[model samples]
Target: MATRRIISTEKTILDKDDDDISSPVAGQQQSSNTAPAVPMDVILKLLAFTFAMVVVPIGSYFLSVNTFFKGNSTYAGGLAAVMANVVLVGYVIVAMNEDQSDQLEAKKKAGKKE
Candidate 1:
């Protein structure tokens, strides 16, 4: 047990030395350089999602239930909620697919490099 512990400690030290010798990897460290700008599409998606989930549902409830369409407010509110949920789910699915593709591409590039 003592020998195993010593070997493990030595291995960790060696790994630390290796990491220190290497230059910083991408995304692990941020330098003084300005960060890359986020794509417009992502910004738009976030804004749209916020509006759908936060604004539309509450606004729909207040407007339909209290102001304009009191008799049909229940239906309007329900529809608004459903639509927001649908948009959220759709956005999640799309984002997941994009991430998966990016990961797969990274793996392919890594494999080629190896």
Candidate 2:
């Protein structure tokens, strides 16, 4: 004897009515916004500043290293490196400011949608 198979298709309670389903609510805007883009001019300026800090003092230290002991020479090189790092930090600050401005602009645009 051969057995027969049956297939059933039924809608669940959740699928009964489209109108009864709730949509997701929109998210709230946060106070701290993203920054805007940095201009090419500003980027070039920062790069120049960084290069100046890193190259000039270090070169000067190298030129004068013969006049000082190894310890003093190392100290001067370290100071130059720290100054270069400070310039790099300035770049970071500028980037962060740009991001904040961008976020605020985005929030303003989103507010308009509401």
Candidate 3:
């Protein structure tokens, strides 16, 4: 009996381009080339609401379970669920208001242009 060895060449070769990989320190104007998809204020609001969504539920669960619910997990869980829904509704309301403001600003700009 004879043993045979097998070789595989499945690796892919990638072409490197100068524009694809750039050092930010090397160019000062690189950041100004493209605007962010989401505005900074919008991103900040999203982050704040996301944090509230997490903290509000857990905090309410713990606090209410001991203080208000008298260690009744059922009531605590229910309160947590309600708090989560409240946070969700609040986020939606805030987003709607922000969108309305943006539309109003656009309308104002259009009016000025005309």
Whole-model lDDT values for every prediction:
0.76, 0.71, 0.87
With candidate 3 superimposed using the best TM-score fit, by how many Å does residue 42's alpha carbon deviate from the native?
Answer: 0.7
Candidate 2 deviant stretches above 4 angstroms? 1-42, 56-71
| Candidate 3 lDDT | 0.87
TM-score of decoy 3: 0.70
Better of 1 and 3 by TM-score: 3
Model 3 lDDT, residue 12, Cα: 28
Q: Taking the tens digit of each residue's C-alpha lDDT, what string does model 1 give over 62-82?
A: 667655666686787786787
Query: What TM-score do all the candidates reach, one by one?
Result: 0.50, 0.44, 0.70
lDDT (Cα, tens digit) per residue for candidate 3, span 1-114: 999554354332332344345555556555554888889999999999999999999999999999998989999999999999999999999999999999999999999999
| Top candidate (TM-score) | 3
State the displacement of the C-alpha of residue 16, model 3, in Å, after optimal TM-score superposition. 23
RMSD of each: 8.1, 10.9, 8.6
Extract clashing residue pairs from model 3.
none
Ranking by lDDT: 3, 1, 2
